[model samples]
Target chain A: MNQIAQEVQHQTHTRLSEVSTEDLIVDIHGLKKYYGDVKAVDGIDLQIPRGTIFGFLGPNGAGKTTTISALITLAKPTAGSGTVVGFDLHDRNNIKKHIGAVFQEQTLDEELTGLQNLKFHAEMYFLPKPVAEQRIEDLTKMVGIHDRLSDKVMNYSGGMRRRLEIARGLMTDPEILFLDEPTIGLDPQSRANILQKIKEMNEEKGLTIFITTHDMEEAESLCDQVCIIDQGKIIVQGTVDELKNSLGNDFVIINFNSPDEMNLAMNLLNDLPEVNEVKSSGSVLHIGTKSGSTAVVKILNTLKEKVEVNSVEIKKPTLNDVFLYYTGKELRDDVADLSDRLKMVGRKKGRRGMMRRR
Target chain B: MYASTSKSQDSYNGFGIFTFIRSIWTVYKRQNARLINSKSQLISIMIMPLLWLVIIGQSFNNLLGSSNPLFSGNVNYITYMTPGIFVMITMFSSLFGIISLFYDRDSGYLKNYLLAPISNTAIIFGYAMGIYTRVFIQVLLILVIAIAIGANIPITVGSLTAIILFPVVVSFFLSGLAITLASRASNVETFQAIIMPISMPLMFLSPILYPIKALPDYLQWIAQINPLSMGVEGLRFVLLGKIYTDGAIIDIAQFNDHLAIFNFALLFLVGIVFLIMGSKTFLNSLYK
Candidate 1:
């Protein structure tokens, strides 16, 4: 854990202790997952309270999937241990029975109809006939795919497929719902719809959701608490605001038309006394500082003197900034690139979206 | 409403054999559902055996003449080749077991099975059942062909009843073997690459096309251990009322010398062994 996360952990520990250990839906201490010489999930300690949406934000190959796999008992930890839904990590059968998951990889049989997929799951989890049918109907209705339940999953749109998967994941009425990048490929409208349904599920049913994603804005909007991991270790773990405040660095996002112009603006802004960090993502150059509002005028004026600034927005420190700060510029680029490719992969084939821990 | 969000009084305690069987049945049912969508594939599967039976049976009979030793005691080339073709169909149809496994694993559907609260044994059993059910259907089609050809098959109730089990035995063992190979295979192409060399060699080397005694000494050694030969000889004995040999036919009767029972037991043992091995390897790969 980094200094900032450690501080947050220490602060949350007192309140967590008072709530009772039973309420700790996820409890991990020094969990490690190694593949040959590669340490996929290095030693990490963390805890998640019940009924909260916990977001795992990280760069590609940073071990977010590995951690989720370990917790879900899909992959064993090489060292250390944890408990999920009150079951030991090694007790995979116990853990599996209590949790539901929509993996980053597609897990549904495309040839089977939506109803058949749910029915298959319902049977595996030992849901009674009437109850299984009832739950399937309820889930389809809730996800708003009740009309297309008979259609083959291969025929369903990306958004509908995601909804079915989510419905199927909840067939057993799990204690913890694991959504590993639930909206990777869907259009903005579909993504927003799924996000809305997720919020409603959280509010109405009080389900604890564990999500892993590279989408910073989505994490900011949906996550109650977020953990940022890089290179198999947690760099920061706290609520959204806590992570942003811990950075104590705001940013001035200045969009420019050309790389040459952004480069000139970057060089000019870095020379300023108030600007702490300057990094460019495509045409947008982000300048970080102690106070973004105070530095905005100087940055705008300096950039205006050299190159035309398209737009200027001074904003609070975001999850993206936290990721850039903690995971390194190169690693964060890898994640951003991965997210772009994953969108295509998730749409093209159900092979795998999340890169395997390397 | 998401039941996962709303706490329900019904909770998981643990599952037992009944649930395990249900899980297996669900896989079996799901596979059946998938198979139903590809109706044309069924015709293609049946065509291989018909072509083999008609082409090989016809050409060999004419070339070798009707006086061949295999045709002795009312057993003609068609009768002799029927069982061999059935064995061929058995091996061919059972390949869907591995093919489906590769498809599921590659396409990520296996994750759903692994994540479920079911035993590894159930998954293997379910897969074997699913594949063999389709194999059984194909076997029935071949049986219809065998009957339509009027190959002088024994028409007794006992013989008819006994013959049905031969294909089932062949299918069970072969499907189990296919599943075992699939667990080790990384992808569909790899599975096919591995399967072709082993399956084809075993089929050609086995006494499926000729009497075991007719094989050369070196080839005979292979035939002795070959499961397909066991199925061919077993099916030949029960269905044709005679077992072809290098010298003469042995009358297939309980009193005279029925080898079908022995072959049946051996096939059972092989099936069990393969099922156990396949399930173990499959379960190991489940989380990997």
Candidate 2:
């Protein structure tokens, strides 16, 4: 009996430690949201760690917004379950208390002043007067819009409006902030300002951020973790290094004088044990390798057997390269074909729904 | 995350009924602020009710001269028409308020409430109460002007209480009707198209410009069933002298009270039922 009791205690302790150690702010499993027969979000599973800046990088129609809508309880999942900020998604009211969001579509009351907009949100969230005022001050200052708080949002610049929206989202002191395209239409300077504020928020409040962006540079600089989604599916997800390392750590681009030489050289390089992947565009051949310094000599020797190497250039890994590596032309074609078929099916299903309702 | 700004949240985290009520009140107050800030629009809205009163009431009175016997009281036909005008103003305002609901939905303002910890009941109630409050102000102005015009309609405390509540009942039901219609509309144009055609029947088929007895028997049935007509007749019973049309003494006063009470009860119940239905439909479909 004592041994059994000890085992149960040990198990309970292990479970608690695991939860705290990983500290997921969001945990989704097989979360599927379908609009008729079009699977907008298809069996997506993600675990976002606490107090980290997470990025969702996707092309248009990639289910980023659909996944967000499900998480925020704006749309119900067709299948599966999830928890956000430790509360079940179905426990929407409780879950809402712990999360704040800035959507792609602007929701500010344009007729009202910035301060009034924030005040309105504070009341909606039931924040007490004193707390609301103080936090309002802090957030406005943090976003660098303290002076324009009294001005109507209609008169404010787009950057100022975006900043005010950020301030308003933080009024309730949410544990996590979701920003859907926070800097989509901003100038470079405005984009930098917003990014800087996001970093400061992560540092000062230790606030976990879940941001979605199409900009690779934004994701590369801001996110501690990223998941790239395409056509209702996650293609790849990991830290920058992990994703870059997925296609070898170092890449060498070998330009040949002839297309035939490039093909022959690519085949010979693939025979080398150190080379990971190879691709050719016109007369240029790109090679992925675990060890560029050691592989370069072997690659040159391999090419020397078939043809002469015209020029060679060594390149570092970047998110752009990671994206290109993961989502090639074939994958895009597959997504387009699947999307067309699904949309046709969706229209038929949707017509039935309209008929039933009518 | 550390509890950087969480100390303030402690007071409001319980989600109590009082807090919900406060949420309703605060939302209404902000709506009030928006209305108050628009001075030109407020004046324009306030002028419409009185304009209908002066123009439509006087022309109808001229058409039905003193001996036309549309009212039993010493008061003129315009006085008999006053109660209907008050309800008419409130009705128009109530219907127009739904356009703003559609605006809020498309504009993303409704999402602030949808994503909040507060109950959906709070949002529906907040919007309902806010629009009613606006209607109340316009209805009150018309009432004061009617009384000032020597249509010094007789009133005791009980009758005065009913008079105050009569327009409220109409506005509440109208606002509920708006909410129900607006729940399915995707844009202002769609909502306006839906609401416009419905407004004509509610306005004309009722006893607004004419009395129930003045119309034919079949139309009188419609007037009797009309919610706005119920409100107009209820208001007349409370604020005017003997109710009459065409020298026929109608038993609609507080002195002879059963039918009036029944109509009042029916209007009140319809108002409440629509409100409840509207609230349920709104919560279910808000984010869908």
Candidate 3:
């Protein structure tokens, strides 16, 4: 019994030391990247704990990719001091060996087979031949690409290519993996598959993952911590529940046939003491409240005589509502219309900043 | 199954000289693999020199007899132009290999190299050396074709060594220029638009097709400073036992040995300069 206890204690100590005493895998203070007159990634601070999925959530042109590029040493920061895996930002080689990256764009060699691509990356990280071969086999199996490893990457489907890239990213068995829009062009099924593989990698290997995405559902479901960023700055950072509860615990969604009715409903809902926040996009009205049951009762009573409700939903708060609550604009890919819509939203509220950090 | 942290760290070492050479070797392998896999491209590259030897060499030989005022040696027209074709092969093979760079960039594959823990110098060296290897093979093929076609080239050890070593210097120079040009080009179209015109001028103004004397006096100066001309003349000196001097073809015995050494030295100097510049440009693009 004593020998068993000592063995268990030694195993625990070995695992803890292997993982490292440093809790933060990525810690950056005042990171910035600029392109001529444009401030692509304005000053921002981030701390990501090890063995967690931390999401940088933003819209298009929101500097999420730029920030990732800076952190990965693909782009040098304009002014900042930071460490990745306890090494300084300028110590790129050390940091690179410790981290893996799946870029927003496809970075796989189309001319090479999937196995060749993985081997090339393995060589870059200086993996021993046998170790590289074993890891390649293991990682391909984990990512469900074991069958396709012999095929050229060009012949792989879009989802298959993403899976191969994910496997390549893990060739080095990095402590932290940085994925920039890992599922941008993939189909819904592929996205789900990729997300599942990412989760498996994290859980099985105890890997820290930093993912940059504009996907609300992805961030909400996959991330342990998330930061909403816009215009090169982080608007807010917290866990999904913390961000959702910051706005409110419950939400009431209403869709109207006409913008006039939605505006009327918005005005009435804004006057309610039970409503924490109200926003309208097109003919839809979203209301944030403490109690979905009570708010729905008050909302129905207030809108009964004045406005005709098309459809209504009472639900818990999501990252979507949290984003709208803070940004005052909907999360969208159309950057051209985003600024114009933002201006109109700002004008409607008579507020200076469309999105403000709390 | 993953190893524990201590074992993993012991297994992976991103620093030190071995990893540096390993990174370069990996990049070099990728380039050669791509080169070998593209059958159509290889066929085209191999056929280009033969076409030049057949059409151009045959037409010039038939148009001008075996003996002409342009011929300062006992060599025939085909023999006279063979060295030029060899240098041209080196130039074309070197420049053509850079198209892969543009392709890699457009396909976003270059980002993988950039994100690797390797230094930029290793990437540049590995890529340049890969092109040199390609040029070496093409030059060897040209040598065989030149000899088979009855070009009166000497089969001396010194001449063969020159043939092997000179293309490396020429490729070093041309690939450097090509990569420097490619670094600033936004896409393949822009790169081709700029490179085609530059390569055409280099081909015409050099001593590849004709002796420097064949050009007008004003153009001779351009040919004089042209690295391609220097490369061709230097190869012509060792291969045909003749070198062009002051717009006149002369026997290698009459040519100043210092001038011959200067020609190679200048090519080496220019190659080193452009390679350094190209590396800087490539690094700038990464940071930017």
Give the winner by DockQ: 2
Report the lDDT tens digits of candidate 3 across residue range B32-61: 887776676577668777888888888888
- A138-204 per-residue lDDT for model 3 (tens digits): 8899888899888888799999999898889888777889999999878999999999989988888
Query: Which residue pairs does candidate 3 place in steric collision?
Result: none
TM-score of every model versus the real structure? 0.86, 0.85, 0.85
> What tens digits encode model 2's per-residue C-alpha lDDT throughout B1-288?
327557656655656888888878877877877787666658877887778777887777778746675453565776777778878887888887756666677667787878887777667777777787777777778777777765546658876677668777787788788878776776565777888887898888887777667777777777667778778876776566453432354423233467667877877788777777887786677665
State the weakest 10-residue window (summed lDDT) of model 2 chain B: B245-254
Question: lDDT of all the models against the reference?
Answer: 0.77, 0.76, 0.79
Worst 10 residues of 3 chain B by lDDT: B244-253
Measured by lDDT, the strongest candidate is: 3
Candidate 2 collision pairs: none
Tens-digit per-residue lDDT, A1-358, candidate 1: 5677677766566656786679989988999999989999899877899989999988777898898888888887888766889988789888888899999977888777899899988877767777888888888999999999988887999999999999999888888899998998789999999999888888888899999987999999999988888889887777888778888888788899888888877777778999888889988998878888888877777766568989888888777877777776533446566688777566444333311110
Global fold similarity of model 2 (TM-score): 0.85
Residue B51, model 3: Cα distance from true site in angstroms: 1.0
DockQ of 1: 0.45
Order candidates by lDDT, high to low: 3, 1, 2
Give interface RMSD (Å), model 1. Answer: 3.1
